[model samples]
Target: MTIFIQSFGYQLWNIITNGPEIPTKLVDGQRILNMNNEFTDHEYKLLQLNAKAKHFIFSNVDRIMVTYEGTNQVKDTKINRLVHDYELFTMLENENISSMYAHFNDIINALKGLGKVVTPRFR
Candidate 1:
């Protein structure tokens, strides 16, 4: 599992550096927003890719925490460490929930590309 997670991390880094296109959908209501600063095509693409990568990383970390094993071999201390890492990542990456939702679409696409076999636990 550690090896698999490392591989996923590497793939995610690649997706971040190389611009990946994520399809967008229109949401109901809300005001129409505009970008105040102009961006080149390449810069726009990079922004999209980074958004997607960040989204996937956040969601996956959450899922991993939800289903983390705390058995004999996997001690409670280990689980706590993993959860702490996830919380730290979330705090460092996301400023607010609104911005997180804004990038949801791109994150979904990135997850889809990663095979979409996440194990999420229900509370």
Candidate 2:
């Protein structure tokens, strides 16, 4: 499936940028972060580690939590989660940050907090 970067509806954008609510998934069984189809097989291999992670996004940051999924295998090599924030777009404008990806990674490392920040590449 093409991982939706952001919902196109104006309502969705409203919720994403200005809305106070953090995005969440259905509260059913275990939830998995799956964006494999968003990439080619080559890119998927590089980012395969994301399969075992849980991503949460709020405000401007996304935290990627690496954890065990259901009764499946466990993961413990990386930090709890990685964050990416669109607020970096502001930095881009100010010329404070260069590559968008690099700036986002820096923000995640610096500002990661208790239970805050998912989503990997796109959006």
Candidate 3:
């Protein structure tokens, strides 16, 4: 699970940095932090945690949340819709389990409330 999350995080970072055309699934959050060199200690920690959570959810749960904008605002309609679809897809793909769905909802809500754009490679 850790490896899965790490790989996903690395791929996500690469996608964000080098454009979304990259056919990869791992996003290296550490690389992103090193590349930016502007994130505060607390922010870096949070980013790492988010990366881990994303990796876990995507790899094991078979769903990914796509936010309309970056994570830096109150829960908007689009973001909420995205989350709903993501959870619904996960439920459909998996065994209709709701644990991961609940976890992702909490994470998305937290990110929406406290997450900043940091340095998105994508525009």
**Model 2: colliding residue pairs:** 56-117, 56-118, 62-83, 62-117, 62-118, 63-117, 63-118, 64-81, 64-82
| Model 3 Cα lDDT, one tens digit per residue, 19-119 | 43311223564322234455566656656665655555556553233332333234455566655554454443454457766866665665465432222
Candidate 2 has an lDDT of 0.39
2 or 3, which is superior by TM-score?
Answer: 3
Off by over 4 Å in 2: 1-91, 94-102, 111-117, 121-123
Of candidate 3, the 10-residue stretch with the lowest lDDT total is: 114-123
lDDT for position 10 in model 2: 40
Clashing pairs in 1: none
TM-score top scorer: 1
Decreasing TM-score order of the candidates = 1, 3, 2
* Each model's Cα RMSD: 21.0, 21.8, 20.6
Per-residue CA lDDT of model 2 for 3-112, tens digit only, reads 33243334344343454232223446755454545456654543432321212243223211222242122221122333224342344555544576677766565444
**Candidate 1 per-residue C-alpha lDDT over 24-97 given as tens digits, one digit per residue, 9 for 90 to 100:** 43358643433536456765766666676788667778665655643433454544544444333342263577
